[model samples]
Target chain A: MASADNVGILGWGAYIPIYRISSDEIARVWGFDDKIPDSIWVEEKAVGAIDEDTVTMSWEASRYALMRSGIDPSEIGAVFVGTESKPYSVKPTATIVAEALGIPPKKLASDLEFACRAASEAIRISIGLVKSQIAKATLVIGADTAQGAPGDLLEFSASSGAAAYIIGNPNQAAAVIVASNSYITDTPDFWRRDGAPYPEHGEIFTGEPAYFHHIVNAVNGLFEEYGFTPKDFDYAVFHQPNGKFPLQVGAKLGFDREKILPGIVTPYVGNTYNGSALLGLAKVLDIAKEDEWILVAPFGSGAGADAYAIRVTDKIEEKRSLAPTVEELIKRKILISYGEYTKMRGKIRKYER
Target chain B: MFKDSVPKYWRLRDVVYRLKYIYCRDCGKSSFPPRSKCPYCGSSNIDHRYSKGNGVVEEYTVMYQSEARYQDYQPIVFGVIRLDEGFRIVAPIVDVDPNSVEEGMRVEATLRRVRVDGSTGLIQYGIKFRPSRR
Candidate 1:
């Protein structure tokens, strides 16, 4: 996982839609018990408005990343968007987001799909690009306006959000990538067929086998390959499908609960799919002190997991406030009832123009 | 008729997405929706430049009733923004309450889904003003 050349994160940004729907509201609409929210460990979830989707959210996040990087948009030689809820099935969301951010044409751009882990793969690819000098900096984004079947359990956690990262030279980075590894298998825990408005999950089947297996393997592999242990790291951020999962996984991996608390964001914002672990990393990056080590693992339900050993640099203290923090974005919210949530999420069909 | 056709939107994407405007070297003025000729000086000696997308709201109105596709965005606050770069553009104000909008509030541009041609059509994204976080 360690490379010859030094590559790291130059800047990072996150976007959570301002609209939110409480677990109680979702429970009421689905005729579920009041204890369901507590049991799931999700209090509320962010929702994209009728006028919002992956592309728009990606742009908002990338724009902030560029601001923090303080580099001209033309310097971005690659832009990759990882999303499940693309507004258009045929058109590439990456080009639209790159164009919106004013990145020039002399760059590589595309949308990657591996469910939630797509963005982590994008980051891995960008590391190669930067390390090889193919691109001075690459923009990697994880964004989704995730969908859940009407009245299904997935509705409680499927939410919308995005997080963007600028991967560049370690000298100018806020955090350097020490090591990384990936573990994947063809196990089908969740999936959405083509043209299906919402996704279908394997209910309880999503646990142990899909999420836990890949994440645990990936993290253990990184530790083995890099000769590092959980105790050596200052913090751990795991892909959070729900609030309880990250904590459970942390304890399973020999990490203290406090070590994972700073990065657990799903309890408040629900599961942002692709944005899940990346958003947690962004939140940790916002507050992590210089010289601290952070371990991150993101899982996607096809399924796969990517683990990284990130070391915060002195540049972090100076660059932390350059853009809106994850906490800032999470705190700025307006709650909506189940009726308004359904309307905004387009659960009820409307007139065709 | 496809008013927001793919080609039509694609052709003017720089203008719509990035607030690209024409700068008249002769008159030292700028105009948005980038025209071939500068409206101020009728000068063809124009160069394209992107706005920082920071501005002040000059005037605004709230539309409670919107077009068919825009029903979900009811009470959209439409505003005339005076950019610091010396150009004015009309855009929708979002992410805030219409009642809280003021005549001289600071605003910044953000890319958002402006419209979709239809269920299977292209999703149009463009700049919309929001209350500045700075």
Candidate 2:
């Protein structure tokens, strides 16, 4: 979906919650097998405070995006939030985020729900919005306070974080979107029924049939669409469910570990669900060089994928100081106990009045 | 004592979302919790303004006692922030130890869930100050 116009990411920002709980600690609390954490390939996961949720995280991230873009928030015409854990099931997360960012009251806003790919879809729509001259710019966000049932295997990787991008013309862009493609299906590898507190996955079924299938199809489609091969990309970022998924998928796509390592954050931050792949892209955008081609593929369960080919621009270096980099937020963390994590995440239930 | 109807929450969204204040063009004085008319000069020459959310603690107090709805987060600390814009505001301080906060300490506003409405079980989100981490 590379638009005819230069509809690329003008600015990018990310927010990782300050609190974290190590996999070892979660394992210890649950009395799980010591070997299980190793299989997840994650050391720790970000945990939002009880006061924080998808709306707050998305707003913070959007603030940084506005700072980096150096655009009046009111000038932007669209605000889209992609998340699986929106605070209110019916209320749109986009309006709260737009208001917090000082975006104009009259604009398009919506909460997209397609698992993790919702934000990526928002990005594609932003490209269309900017290309059609319908908007001066558009804000697309991916964020989540992802949860797994207590003592469940998914707990090791479910995490909280957010990433946002302001997409506009190349004059203000950090990178130009060279091309994009998506693959979708009725795969229900992961889902949370209405009123369910945490999501459930089909274990191995989440791997082969859902994540891998969508990602490979979308990326292969991108390659075919643009007549480009893996060697043309300087770096590759695949959706990271666990630390291993990105690397495994990257290898399958003919990318080396070195090319994929820089974009992978789940090893330390765990999976941020909707924020997972976009945050990785933010990390790449933070360090990518002029004309370097970076391939990003986001796979969301239930399930679909969006693959993007982006070429970095020199402007990225100039806007780096406008907001805190993703690395800075990732490093600004304090380790919390499993008990403290529960308290901060509000997992503790109250029984007394 | 934190029960809010939906309209009240929506009405005060500007105060919490981005610290949007109002400037009295007639007197050049700024007032928060935006007003329809200028407070200082009693004039209608008012303009919308924003606070950078950076300030210093003018005074602070720690409360160990709490209401039933806030028992989980007891010992709440509140401060009067002397903002860079030359106005002062009272707000709860977070992400810092309750006892460590002192007057003249640097603080920044961050969006957070302030209190939950007990009657409606709806959460109220607002700006809360915290020690400037940077």
Candidate 3:
């Protein structure tokens, strides 16, 4: 595997849909007790507008990334969209993104699926592409309008969002990846069968055997491989399935609340499926200072995790402001009722027939 | 609600993504949904000029019972937009109340999904205009 430190991220951007649905509203419909919020550690989740989907959100994010990088789209050698909830099962979402950005036909493009951590896989591939001289620059995006069965527990955190990163050489590097590690297995703790509208989970099985194990094992492996301790990092971001999972996993891995909480947005935006960890990383990049080391661990159900050690550079302070910040998007909220959420989600359209 | 072949849509993408219009230098007329032949002068002498996607509403209408993909956005609104650059084109008007729509409203073109074919068919994305806040 190519070391993350060898490749640098030139730009980064985040997108959280403006619409939000409160957990209390979901509780009202499902008749769950008031403890739901505390239990799930989510107050609300971002919801995409009727016109929005993974592709559109990804476009919004990648455009910002391009703005921050200030690079010509034609110069981008590869484009990758990592999402399980892609608009078409057979078609390539990357092509639409490339075409929208006016990328030249000689570039490479493809969609990646690994439940939630698919975008991390794209990042890994991009590192190799840039490092091996295969590509001058690459675009990797994680976006999803995650679906949960109408009233399932998954609904609590299944949300819409996207994050994009442009990886290039140190000439424009806003941040450097110092180390990287990945752990994966065929553990089916959560999944949606082919053509199914929503995903099904093992419920209790998702927690112990799936998310925690993969994230922990990957982070530990990265630490062991690099001979670094938790205190070596100034901040930490874990795959935020909900607000709670990242916090709980961080605590178990010997990280402080202050270290983990800075990157935790799932409390307000829910889990954006593929975008979860990447968004967390983008938010951290927005505020992190030069020489600061941050740890990132992203887990995907059925199940795997990629652990990264990143070092913020002087370029981050300048490039971060060139594009929209995660905080700015979070502040520009338009709360919606559950009925409105269902309408925007297009649930009513298919149900009426 | 419009659907077409993948090749046609692929070709249209370059036009809609940037609002690229072919300028008929012969008559100095510009049109969108770019034409190979000039609509005014019958001249093939043309240049591709990109629109800023900013324009004003010249005419308007509301549509209900739209296509399957657009059913959720019932009462779809559309209008004729007169571009600042001396051309008129018809497109969807969005981000406004149906009752509030009227003539002479300022609008800006944005990319949006137009329609989808069968349950698992091609998705057509195109330019739609929203009332310009500016």
Candidate 4:
């Protein structure tokens, strides 16, 4: 029965796999011509090895968040992991992560499933929990290991990564959660059938029906609901299944390309499903100035969106010195060949016996 | 064949090299591997101090032999020493015959190789204590 406005993001962390799969290599293997863009817009996509999954990635991201926030794990009242791919069909991945982090058992904990928008929803839920005084702090994690049907355009961009945020009251916060809005629809633009190995998406349909429509409506709805305009935001990050979508949507919303450029993590990391948009937002927060406004919109496959407006605080500038930024992470050298990508993504087996 | 668990360089140059450990000024508790604040007091007030690297032998053990890769050195002598600073550290002891090992003997820290990290290709140094010559 608590309001979400009372809760704010206290700390944020991100993780992109060390290995990179060049779009050029993808094009070469797929037999696409040299004229095709290396990444439809960016140059490469990050690929996690076979050993990593949503759970492992969330653990790493949360480690960074806990370290940066200096928040004791025992103080957290809730643990929420939002992902499309659960490590197990029935067991809650959140419980596993909570146990690994040594968080106390007497806490509110659950896994959220809403396609890519689940993480944003988790954030909203944490805000409400803090507002109602039911919980003093919550750790919201978004992660995914998105698999695309072989030879599809999605294969080139669907990769794995994760992001996490510690949300709590403003007095104990690092950034203020200014406002948020949700744009929902029952459009099934993309989906994976039961037991299907990969997701099936309506290519051109996904563009207008889900990505464009939902993002535009969400941004506009947040503006209408909060009485703010595009110019008021310093950065706008959308669920980037591919690099071009966020830029295309930003242009439609009257935002300058530069404003959204810093939040575009897909060019280097690919679509991390639930973590895509939030990863971009985390990067922006790394270099954002105090009081700077940031807008985030995450669109899911079945068709739903969550948009949030946040303002950076002095704590952000203070915490900036403690952790590595997206730029620093980007400078690490990790190269994977086309064959390795196939192996890492489980497209091919090494021991076909 | 058993693979060499440690690298040749680390085995040859055994120094327990770590970022210096710091102790809390308010609470004389020592921190291993070093930290900016004391975990006990949560105070950033701390100072770096070197371990005397000498201690009383708390326990001792002997390995009749090791895996094939390390077979050249048979009957290894390993021991744990309780340092004057109130911490227990484990290391291999050399110079004294393995059959002559005994507990409560005074020992001093000595440099020796620990292991090899395949990725970085560098020798890791560790502290091994030997009976004090004095």
Candidate 5:
């Protein structure tokens, strides 16, 4: 449903780690051919430091969101972190983020898991909260340090990053949330068992049956309900499992390649999983002009997808520079070796008493 | 024997999370790791404040040795930062080359994993500094 009230994005921010490992490095170590990275359309992927995790990245991104919005931490009514890579299995990552941001004792705080679409769901939930007046504003974060087996194709794409947004009154928003909806199913194209460190996928089954099916259905659901066509939007961002999937999906949905190109980030930073589509939206927000329309479709392989129609406002020009832009964060990189990547990712066993 | 205590970390959450300080209104100075009594003027009249997180490195050193738990993150650069507001606190510098850090370099605060008790214990998170872009 379209928000009855004026619920919009107050601010947006992203955090990408500086460390990087090329697809070539991963390929060489695993005895894969050189064209493997090219086949996936990923050159390099961002890596979190040994000391960093989902919680720390979420805090950094949220801090910037607060800075851009100029909102006091106590005023936030809800906090949500969507990730598959939470540091602790039982402890909540959201409380740690809320506390680090000084968001006070009274707030709706919890972690949500839907593979990758959890943060997208957080945004949809925040829109409802603001529309109903249950909260004046809310913080929604998408972050991940996704895992892949040593010799698996996922190793080239499972990376780390975070994107955060503040949802509040439309009058204070940089971009208004026109409408949003989600589509989900019992499709199990990708999964990791409860205690498994690395996830397994259904290979090509992840493409058409999982990612494409859920995302197309979600976007079509919005189009059918809202009467919006592909031509109506100035830009479209899809969950980027690789550099090629977004373009392929966009083409399938009748959107031009040009409209989807600006939002594709997986080629450079790898698939930040939760951060993939959100980070693309953040980049578009940084460069989009007043009144421009953006189509956001984020898919998670459990599987599900959330589609949002966003309209930019004049406030974007002023608020865009309040925090570091996604492009700038992506450029601040230090390439590491395959061995270093293994170390940072904790692939090595450690001794303990 | 105890590796660490939850109460110790919980009690100092504010300071640990945000780098909080107590500004002695009477003395016009800020004391970090905030306390009820001001160290400079011995006054109880103080207000809790958070550092703007902008600072400059006053001095720094790289530690190649540490307790076993911290071995994964060795060659850690420890620096004494003087916040833009003019109070000094020591913290680890991350996201940059350890050998490249120098005196008077600009820095900014960021939350990070300070330590973890073990596989089953709490993961303590606190404020750390990194090279500032602006």
Candidate 6:
């Protein structure tokens, strides 16, 4: 087996749907004071039309990663789909995506559900696959069409998006996986009861107890264990439920705003749940120079964080031809009305039948 | 659910018989029964579109018994057929001996009544594939 550091990301891709819904409109309908920032912190949110879901979004992101990596689908030895919003309760969303991508049945495939951090977990699992030589390439996808009760803060921010990374041997990698650390706690700040349409979350409790505590702990742990200071990293991205949290956390950690600002995606697209932080990291990698260091920390509602330190490589410049950059996606947005947002979010009517 | 009260189509799905499958024009993919959209391309842009309905058997298995509603038709033959257009479907083969069903054997889709619920229930028709006439 190869050393753990031998495994790294070979390629990365992201997808944020074309639609956007303004926060001011949400504040008007919910009767909140217009002066107050809508709970989401974004002017608008991206939504997936009826046909899109975690499975579809993951497929799109994976397709781009595969194309960018120039790796054949048949060569993928394992596929992990990290999602909270699976299409079916019993069926595995990974199998659906694997089949569509033409991954053979002999490969290891499964779905992971750990609130928002599931995709980061998938990345770790793929790293193990590459290090052990069990597979030459593994595809890790984090995607969600997250839902929140209508009129709740989560509703304004819970959006749809996906991100995928192809993990393989470092010598064959597009970016070197330097170090990773995790901080976990059994906190129930947010949860959805079974058969419930939307998730219920504790308002202020989600911040300090769940998001801030876990992310800060993981980032500090990574720095301490790896013997690197915050300044050693060039780019940092966090699981963004809203724009304010990442900036606030960065300030507390003694990091400047400019270091974190470039990777922030929530202010424009709202919270993508599972895809939030990872998609931002994908955006950063698109423009980062070779050998530049990057720090990624993702937090979930149940209270867990996965922090990775990566170093970009020359291969990223070559692979960029196959996938769309964050700038391209942001520029191509389509505005939608408040009522359309309700319909797209599946809050207005039951159309599954 | 009681065997007698079950719908004819639900009961027919139990018995061994061939049925027709349809493909969509926009995506060029075949599906069993029929679907409103191509699951791969997610295009509602679909047509009832006929199936060339001919393919080769991909795999097969025989069952000793089926559900209570299909108890009358014991010993069922089930298999997945790979169509000529590159889509695969699952169904029961008919009008041929069980031993004769092998992988790569040419088959054609046909309309057949798979099962009848009780004595006075509706006769449900479905599309199933069988040994091709050609």
Considering only chain B, report the TM-score of model 6: 0.71
Tens-digit lDDT track of model 4 for A199-240: 888878998988899988988988887778888899988889
Ranking by lDDT: 5, 1, 2, 3, 6, 4
Residue B115 miss distance in model 2 (angstroms)? 2.6
Which residue runs of candidate 5 sit more than 4 Å off their true CA positions? A1-6
Candidate 3 local lDDT, A215-280, one digit each (tens):
999999999888878999999999988888888899899999999988988998999989999999
Candidate that scores best on lDDT = 5
Best by TM-score: 5
Tens-digit per-residue lDDT, B62-101, candidate 2: 8788877776666778899988987789998876767688
Native contacts present in each candidate (fraction): 0.78, 0.47, 0.31, 0.00, 0.66, 0.00
Candidate 5 residue lDDT tens string, A1-353? 44433588999999999999999999988999999898889999999999899999999899888888878888899999999999999989999999888898889999999998999999989988999989989999999999989999999999999999999989998999898879999998999999999998999999999999999999999888888899889999999999999999999999999999988888999999889999999989989999999999999988999888999999999999999999899899999998888888899987784
What are the interface RMSDs of all the models? 2.0, 2.4, 3.7, 16.7, 1.8, 16.5
**Which stretches in model 2 have alpha-carbon errors above 4 Å?**
A1-5, B1-3, B36-45, B118-121
The residue pairs that clash in candidate 6, if any, are B18-B127, B18-B128, B18-B129, B19-B127, B19-B128, B19-B129, B20-B127, B20-B128
Query: What's the residue-level lDDT of A214 in candidate 1?
Result: 94
Error of 2 at A52 (Å): 0.2
Clash-forming residue pairs, model 4: A2-A132, B10-B113, B11-B113, B14-B111, B14-B112, B14-B113, B15-B112, B15-B125, B15-B126
Q: Give lDDT tens digits, candidate 4, residues B1-134.
A: 22344554333321243224667889878765566898779888898765757678889898887754233234667898777776566777754668778999998754333432332343244456667643
Candidate 2: C-alpha lDDT:
0.86
Q: Candidate 2, residue A167: CA error in Å?
A: 1.3
**Model 4: residue A104 alpha-carbon error in angstroms:** 1.1
lDDT of 5 at A296: 97
For candidate 5, the C-alpha RMSD (Å) to the true structure equals 1.3
Kindly list the per-residue Cα lDDT of model 1 for residues A1-353, writing each as its tens digit.
35433588989999999999998898887899989899989999999977888998998888888877778889999999998887878888999898888789999999999999999999999989998899999999999999988788888899999999999989989999978899999988999999999888888889999999999999999988878899889999999999999999889899999999999899899899889999999999999999999999999999999889999999998888988999999999989888888887888987664
